[model samples]
Target: MGLITPIGFFSIVQKPSDRTHDTLTVRARMRGDLAALK
Candidate 1:
């Protein structure tokens, strides 16, 4: 719990939106790859 708090704080300070953008980008890539496979 203690370690997680620091990491969470760092993320919010460094780039709060980074995680959401990354998740969307990865989801898009996965969809493209699946479409290609089919």
Candidate 2:
């Protein structure tokens, strides 16, 4: 069906986005800690 391609693409795209989102969150937290330390 036509819907299958988007579903497959979204699954692939979502994983990396989740990883990047997690990495960004961790970096932000580290930056906050650094600011607090200063």
Candidate 3:
């Protein structure tokens, strides 16, 4: 899932499963003004 903010972005991954492991992770990123998308 993803979200947009005034100066950045947010992302999250829940219950990610690999061949031998299940991991939980949270990620974030920065972005420019997405005037067109708004």
lDDT of each: 0.33, 0.34, 0.54
Tens digits of per-residue lDDT for model 1 on 1-38?
A: 11233213211122457666653212223344435434
TM-score of each: 0.23, 0.23, 0.37
- Candidate 3 per-residue lDDT, tens place, 1-38, comes to 88775655766576536324666544565333333234
Scanning candidate 3 in windows of ten residues, the lowest lDDT window is 29-38
Please tell me which predicted candidate would have the highest TM-score against the true structure.
Answer: 3
Indicate the TM-score of model 3.
0.37
List candidate 1 stretches off by more than 4 Å.
1-29
CA RMSD (A), model 1: 12.8
Off by over 4 Å in 2: 1-29
Top candidate when judged by lDDT against the true structure: 3
Model 1 C-alpha lDDT versus the unseen true structure = 0.33
lDDT of 2 at 18: 75
